[model samples]
Target: MTYSLLNLAFLVPAAVLALVATLRVPHRRRFLRGLGLTLLVVLVLTAIFDNVMIGIGLVAYEREHLSGVFIGIAPIEDFSYAVFAAVVLPSLWSLLRPSRRRPRAHA
Candidate 1:
């Protein structure tokens, strides 16, 4: 499969997990704001580092696998991994965290 298709294969599930976590987790507003900020930071860093790596020939992507969209020399597909990480890591963390509740008082 093409790179974009492969990226979507992982990204779709990660996005779904993130959405479910956003709905089920407490403090929806806070989680969303944090997710947004995390995405922004990751995207920016990925773009800068990816472009530098590509320019230096340390990183290379097959042109046929790319969508022809780019931010600098990095294919847009390159950013999806960061996006997936930003969404999936927090979702998995929230999902796996132990619930906190006090035991009921004895009669």
Candidate 2:
């Protein structure tokens, strides 16, 4: 399969995990805010590093698998990995966190 198809296969599961995590976890607003911030940081870092790697011939993508889009030398499709990490990691963390219990009041 082409790289683009492989990316799509992974992305669909990552998106679903993020959605289920947001719905099931507590503090939805905070989780969303954190996710947004994470996405922004990941996007910036991926753009810088991926472009630099491609520029120096340390990395490359097969043109046939790409959608003919570019952000500098990095293929636009490359950003999907960073985005998947940002969403999936935090969602998994939230899902796996230990639950907190409230103290009982004395009568």
Candidate 3:
């Protein structure tokens, strides 16, 4: 298939949201840096998973009408899923942690 301009449009918003979320972590900037490092790890894992699936005949590509990018057996669009999951996972994990609000004393 010809590259979908519509599909390609998604990357801008995804990257913007990742940037915004990473910048909003209260005073824990170091945590955000570590989160970015973690995201790299997650991206690698997802790419490997997708590669294995494609290798085992679990997924197939329509090569004749395909978009022009590939990573080994995986398509370029496929890797974006990995990037998206990596960026989102840390933001979601931070939300699950308890907040640091101090207890108020009785008046």
Candidate 4:
């Protein structure tokens, strides 16, 4: 399979987890706002760093397996990892972590 297909396979589950978190977690507006900002920052950083890494020969992809879409030298398929960082992991953290507002346990 192509890199884009691999990215899609990973991204679909992460997107579902993020969606579930949006529904079940508290402070929906804040979560969305933070998600947007985080996505923006992470994507930009990923673009810059990925381009640099590729330029310097620190990273490489086979042309046959790539989607042929790029931001500079970085493959577009590379950005799904940034989405996972900006969205899925945070959603999982929020979903899995105990709430700060939980009532103190009775003695």
Q: What is the C-alpha RMSD of each candidate to the true structure, in Å?
A: 0.9, 1.7, 3.0, 2.1
Candidate whose lDDT is highest: 1
What is the Cα-based TM-score of model 3? 0.68
Worst 10 residues of 1 by lDDT: 94-103
Clashing pairs in 1: none
List the pairs of residues colliding in candidate 4.
none
Residue 14 CA displacement from its true place in model 3, Å: 3.1
Instruction: Give the poorly placed runs of model 4, Cα more than 4 Å off.
Output: 102-107
Model 3 Cα lDDT, one tens digit per residue, 23-85: 666756776677778777876786788889999999876676467787777777676665666
- What digit string (tens of lDDT, one per residue) describes model 2 on residues 13-107? 99999999999987999999999999999999999999999999998878888888888889888999999999999999999988887789999
For every model shown, the clashing-pair count is 0, 0, 2, 0
Estimate the TM-score for candidate 4: 0.90
Task: Please give, for residues 1-107, the per-residue lDDT of candidate 1 as tens digits.
Answer: 67999998999999899989999888999999999999999999999999999999998988988899999999999999999999999999988899887889999
lDDT of each: 0.92, 0.92, 0.70, 0.89
For residue 107, what is the lDDT in candidate 3? 94
Q: What is the TM-score of each candidate against the true structure?
A: 0.95, 0.91, 0.68, 0.90
- Candidate 2, pairs of clashing residues: none
